[model samples]
Target: MKTIRLFSVLLFALSLSSALSQAAKPATVSVNRIGDGPIITPELDQRMGGNIQGPSLIKVPKWIENPIGQYYLYFADHRGEYIRMAYA
Candidate 1:
């Protein structure tokens, strides 16, 4: 009986926490249009250079402190040898 009562309280607490949680939505967005500069520039770094491929980017959330600009670009070498970053 005591075990069941504790389980019910825990279940109720979990449900209430889920109900209070909300999905995050960004307040501002920066879109790269079709004619905008190439997302991957081959000459970003000549030493570790290979044709820059598979670009991934993340826009900073307002609540987070980003020392860089509004968005960040991240990419890795094909063999996972190196991961590089850029800010914009």
Candidate 2:
């Protein structure tokens, strides 16, 4: 019936829109000042993670454009901790 056909089309469109909505990632990131001095210190290293035994310094560029959320910061310490901090 025409009603069933229209309902099927509506459902398809709704499903497509829902998928697209879920696919979009938000563009949000945390930032730290480049020369603010010790965003993370040896004392605070434990908060960041184990093995982050030094002063934190920002080594990333001030401006980064990641619309798709493909980019990540990874660490603020010398150690390979799973941290993320952008510099601005």
Candidate 3:
């Protein structure tokens, strides 16, 4: 009984440490853009809007810090027809 209790405790401790280590790592995401050509600027892209074609997927590090303000980083995805947005 004592040996079983000690093993259980050790197993729990190991699991907790593993979880903590994984949690400590920064989050990441994949960015996918479906377009033919790259837009030169945000303003131009907004004005012209989806003038390009083709599809691309990029994996990049996620932003860790969010500023203390009203503005926030919004994530989005869309098909040629519909759009979606999420607050981070």
Candidate 4:
């Protein structure tokens, strides 16, 4: 408990000092839309039915077969009747 408290106090003091030392400035960030809408939609791709769910997107590992973008999406519908995947 004593060690944890001391660590916490030290962390808090360090963070406070760092925050005080840094000057506040406006963020120089821009929002550029890659696309107006989703790449795959029910209207565009009729393969999928309604109630699409469980979308898990991940980057392909170095060992695995990487696609053009090295990323893929695993998705299923609400009923989970079928699982579909798309790579880019």
TM-score of 3: 0.29
Which candidate would rank higher by lDDT, 2 or 4?
A: 4
- What are the per-residue Cα lDDT tens digits for candidate 2 across 1-88? 9999999999999999999988968889897566867444446445665455433444444465553343333344446555555343
* Model 1 lDDT tens row, 1-88: 9999999999999998887786466689566578758767667667556756578878787888646789888887777778888888
lDDT digits (tens) for residues 38-85 of candidate 4: 655667467687678877878788787635668888888788688888
lDDT for model 2 comes to: 0.58
Highest-scoring model, lDDT: 4
Q: If scored against the real structure, what TM-score would every candidate get?
A: 0.52, 0.28, 0.29, 0.51
Error of 4 at 32 (Å): 7.5
Pairing residues by index, what is the TM-score of model 2? 0.28
Q: Model 2 Cα RMSD, Å?
A: 12.4
lDDT of 1 at 16: 85
Question: In order, what lDDT does every prediction score?
Answer: 0.77, 0.58, 0.49, 0.79
lDDT score of model 4? 0.79
Scanning candidate 1 in windows of ten residues, the lowest lDDT window is 44-53
Q: Tell me how candidate 1 scores on lDDT.
A: 0.77
